[model samples]
Target chain A: EPEVTQTPSHQVTQMGQEVILRCVPISNHLYFYWYRQILGQKVEFLVSFYNNEISEKSEIFDDQFSVERPDGSNFTLKIRSTKLEDSAMYFCASSKPTGGNTEAFFGQGTRLTVV
Target chain B: AQSVSQHNHHVILSEAASLELGCNYSYGGTVNLFWYVQYPGQHLQLLLKYFSGDPLVKGIKGFEAEFIKSKFSFNLRKPSVQWSDTAEYFCAVNPPNAGKSTFGDGTTLTVKP
Candidate 1:
C-alpha cells in the first residue's frame, strides 16, 4: 500500500537553529497534516495544509512554524528557531478528500532532539 | 474545547483473552471517530473508523468498535487477542468538515503468551 514518507528518521539540532522536516505524501492525497508527540504525551495536531495553503493550525503552531508544499509531492515543515521544548516525534500524514469520512495515513515520524 | 479521553493507560492480558479499550470524546458537532494502533517502531495505522453508518463498525484484524452517540463514546473491542496485538492504541475525533484530529493519550496493551 502507498504510504506517506518522511525524511531523516532522527535529527539533533542546536537551540536557536533552524530545521526543516520533509514529507512526501501519497501521490493522490489532497490533504496533508503535521502532528507532534512529546515524550509520554498525547499526539497533538499542529497544522493542516490543502490547496497549497494552510487550512488550519493550532496554538502550538505559532509564528516560528511554517509549512510548504513547494512541489507536487513534497510537503515540509520548518521551524525558525528550535527550543528545548521542541524536542518530540513529528509525524506527517495525508488523506484523500473523500467527503466527510476521510482517513489519514501516517509516516514513521521524524524524531527531533533539540539541545 | 474538543478533546478525547482514553480510560486505560496500560493493560496486560494473556493470549486468547478478550479485550476492550474505552474511548470518549467531547465534541458537540458531528464528528468522525477512529481507532489507530502503533506497533513497536512502526507508524500509526488505522484500525477502524465510525462515520455515519451503523453504530457498530468492524475494522481490520477482527477488531471492532461501537459508536455510542448518546454517551459520546467509541470503544474498541476484540473477542480474542493474540501476542501480536500488543501495541499502543489511540482514539481520535475530528469534526466532519475538518482535517485536524484530536487524539487521546494512548493506551499501552501488552499481551502475554
Candidate 2:
C-alpha cells in the first residue's frame, strides 16, 4: 500500500535555529496535513494543505511555522526559530477526499528535538 | 469545535483477554471516525475507520469498532489480545469534508504475556 514518507527520521537542532521537515505524500492524495505530538500528549493538528495552499491551521501554528507544497509530491514544514518546547514528533499525512473516506495515511514521523 | 475523548488512559490485560477501549467525540455534524495505533517508537497506523456503512467495522489484527451515532461513541474491541497488541491507541474524528483530524489523548494498552 502507498504511504506517506517523511525525511530525516530524527533531527536535533539548537534553540533559535531553523529546521525544515520534509514529506512526500501519496501521489493521488489531494489533502496534506502536518501534526505533532509532544511526549505523552495527544496528537495535535498543525496545518492542512489543499490545492497547494493551506486550508486550515491551529492556534499552535503561529508565526514561527509555515508549510509548503513545493512540488507535486513534496510537502514541507519549516520552523523559522525552534524553541525548546518545539521538541516533538512531527507527522505528515495525506488523504484523498473521496466522499466519506477521507481517512489519512500517516508517515513514520520525524522526531525533532530542540536543545 | 470538535474534540475526541478517550475514557481509559491506561489499561493492563493478560494474553487471550478480551479488550475494550471507550471513545467519544463532541461533534454536531456529520463526522468520520477512526482508530489508530502506535507501537513503541513507531508512527501512527490506522486500525479501523467508520465512514458511511454499517455501524460495526472490523480492522486489521482482529480489531473492530462500533460507531454509535446517537451517543457519539466509537469504541474499539478485541476478542482476545496478545502481547503484540500492547500499544497506544488513539481515537480521531473529522468532518466529512475537512482534512484536519482531532485526536483523543490516547489509551495505552499493556498486554502482558
Which candidate gets the maximum TM-score versus the true structure?
2
- The CA lDDT of each predicted structure is 0.92, 0.94
lDDT of 1 at B92: 97
* Candidate 2, B1-113: lDDT as tens digits: 99999999999999999999999999989999999999988899899998887999999999999999899999999999999999999999999877589999999999999
lDDT of 1 by residue, B1-113 (tens): 79999999999999999999999999878899999998876678889988898999999999999999999999999999999999999999888766578999999999999
- TM per candidate comes to 0.92, 0.97
Q: Which candidate comes out best when scored by lDDT?
A: 2
In the order shown, the candidates' DockQ scores are 0.64, 0.79
Stretch of 10 with least lDDT, candidate 1 chain A = A96-105
Q: Where in model 2 is the C-alpha error above 4 Å?
A: none
Worst 10 residues of 2 chain B by lDDT: B92-101
Question: fnat, candidate 2?
Answer: 0.72
Evaluate model 1: give its TM-score: 0.92
